[model samples]
Target: MAYEVLVQSVVDYAIYLLDREGRVSSWNPGAERIKGYSPGEILGKHFSRFYTEEDRHADVPEAALGPSLGGDIQFETAVP
Candidate 1:
């Protein structure tokens, strides 16, 4: 389907889905570029792996998700 092809071809932003528990459920090429993780390496892993240890330790990662899912949070990071 065209939708599937479009999703597969995306390379700008890391397009992915996470379960309520924050585990990575899917990944695309953009995810590889943004996160330095291959789909094979990241699938089924906790999305928190992208966070710094201090953030994870403070539970900030989990807190951020609440706002993000509610459209109350917007993240802007420089990738380079």
Candidate 2:
């Protein structure tokens, strides 16, 4: 589909889809390039792995599930 093509072509921004439970449902090329996880390794995994320990302890991931208006949530990560 056109959307898949666009997501695959973009390399600057990581574009992915997470299920309602925060599980990674779709992994795009940009996501693999930026996050360093191939789809095989990351697909169906909980996205909280990207959050810092403090963030996880503070329930930041839970808070990030805000209104489903399709917006972005900026967070600090421990991954280098």
TM-score of each: 0.76, 0.79
Q: Which stretches of candidate 1 lie over 4 Å from their true place?
A: 68-80
- For model 2, residues 1-80, the per-residue Cα lDDT tens digits are 99989888888889999998888999888899999899999999988788878888987776677544466676544553
Worst 10 residues of 2 by lDDT: 71-80
Report the C-alpha lDDT of model 1 over 1-80, residue by residue, as the tens digit.
88767877999988898987888988989889988899889999988778777767876667768865774654443223
Clashes of each: 0, 0
TM-score of 1: 0.76
Measured over all alpha carbons after superposition, the RMSD of each candidate to the real structure, in angstroms, is 3.1, 3.3
lDDT of 2 at 8: 84
Local distance difference test, each candidate: 0.79, 0.83
lDDT (0-100) at residue 34 of candidate 2?
Answer: 90
